[model samples]
Target: MSITVNPDWWKTLFDEVYLMTDARSVCNEDITRLEVDVICELLPIRSQSKILDLCGGHGRHSLELCARGFSCCTLLDYSQVLIDYAKARAAECNLSIEAVQSDARSTGFPDESFDHVLIMGNSLGYIKGPADSQIMSEAFRLLRPGGWFLVDVTDKSAIKRDFNPEAWHEINDDTVVCRKREIKGDTIHAREMVLNKQKGLIRDQTYAIRLYGSQTLASLLEAAGFQQVTVRTGFSPHASKGNYGFMNNRMLATGRKM
Candidate 1:
């Protein structure tokens, strides 16, 4: 018997994209009731501020901000498929949000174009290379001085303190899986064990990701020319103190161009 397998670390193993989409809808439905409040605080959205949702997959936050009277809220993503979905969502909501397909590191926007920029939903952790610096630099270039740029990412402490490098749980009645990984300089070595639950036997799969720390990320952002880098706890500072088995849950970093 043949079994499909996951090879892409956290994204493929657990594959939380659906959860992300559902989370997006939840954030939109309740507006302020979300996991990350730091984005709102750093937005500087004065009802007239021009906002750009950088790498915004489905316009969730953009749509919410628009409802709150943001002068301009544009959704920018690299995937045309996601862009199409986002545009359709905007249309369905009767909102005139601009949806564009563009790389986050090289968005084709003029200098000082937006007053506030939001890169959220743990999207910042996906980019895994030196190019991250370029993305940060581009963010600085895209916004006016003192403009807000909010980034949502996993806290380094949380990840280091809790990342189960070796573990697995049941995915279905027919499959159970576990994985292990090791970081060696610039690369990740990984392995996974999968069992066919129905057959009461073991199957196969794997996962890997290049490790990065918050300090490494901060340096990248700083070198990109962002100033006043500030980190916040939780999804939004307004969270009612939820615990994630660690002191830091998710972190939001806000930097201003100055």
Candidate 2:
């Protein structure tokens, strides 16, 4: 007899190998620190503000925010392995954070539970269909009145301007990853292969992310009942540089629940 696996690639893609690849990617501690600083400056955070790090893989930003004196920090992600890793790291650092394994599309938290919601690390566009809209709606629901929501994603504009079909990079001395990409009707399909000296060829996985322009994303946020939607390009801690137009490979969008 033959068995079939679930079609949800995200379920399997976030395993150990995925974590290793991510560690080598833009998801390192230094980047997390810079992102946290930018978030702190943009949002009206207080000592008692409840912050939800939505889709926060491994609680990097959550832990950093907690260390910076934001006490009530909750890190939520769909991957149990990542949640466990975040919990271990939080314990090791003697920091207290609520780490929950939950889907970003429909988080079970109560309405208006958070004072601020952060969706970072190009995590917004992963879901296949109207699910992205649902994610935005859920973020709107989770925030209190006047709460802030921040989202960071790859700049579709820049990607279109300079499309690279294939790229390879060394994550470490012993491991390298190659990515082949193709854009098909608003979705960027990607195939990734990880090569390791000891393990040989680790694995190959394919995934798709729906691309969005600044106006499209801002409209989505507005449709979800967000106000003061601001879209910016590039990642910078400085407000002036961060709010500039789409000139870099990454983009950021922030809104307020009013």
Best by lDDT: 2
Residues 1-258, candidate 1: write the lDDT tens digits. 222224333333322333222332333455333432345655666877788888777677787777666748888877666678778777887887888988888999999999988886556534455556777888899999889888766565555656555655555556655556554454345565656745654434443443445666566668888888877654433244332211136567778898
Q: Report the C-alpha lDDT of model 2 over 1-258, residue by residue, as the tens digit.
A: 122223487777886787677663335666678878888878999989999999988888999999988999999999999899989999999999999999998889999999999988778666666888999999999999999999887778777767777777677899988877788877777788999999899978887777888889899899999999999875543234221122135778899999
Candidate 1 matches the true fold with a TM-score of 0.70
**What shift in Å separates residue 92 of candidate 1 from its native position after superposition?**
1.4
Stretches off by above 4 angstroms in model 1 are: 1-37, 125-128, 165-212, 234-248
Per-residue lDDT, model 1, residue 72, is: 89
- TM-score of every candidate relative to the true structure: 0.70, 0.90
lDDT (C-alpha, whole model) for all candidates: 0.63, 0.81
Top candidate (TM-score): 2
Error (Å) of candidate 2 at residue 257 is 1.1
What pairs collide in candidate 1? 35-235, 36-235, 36-236, 37-235, 37-236, 194-203
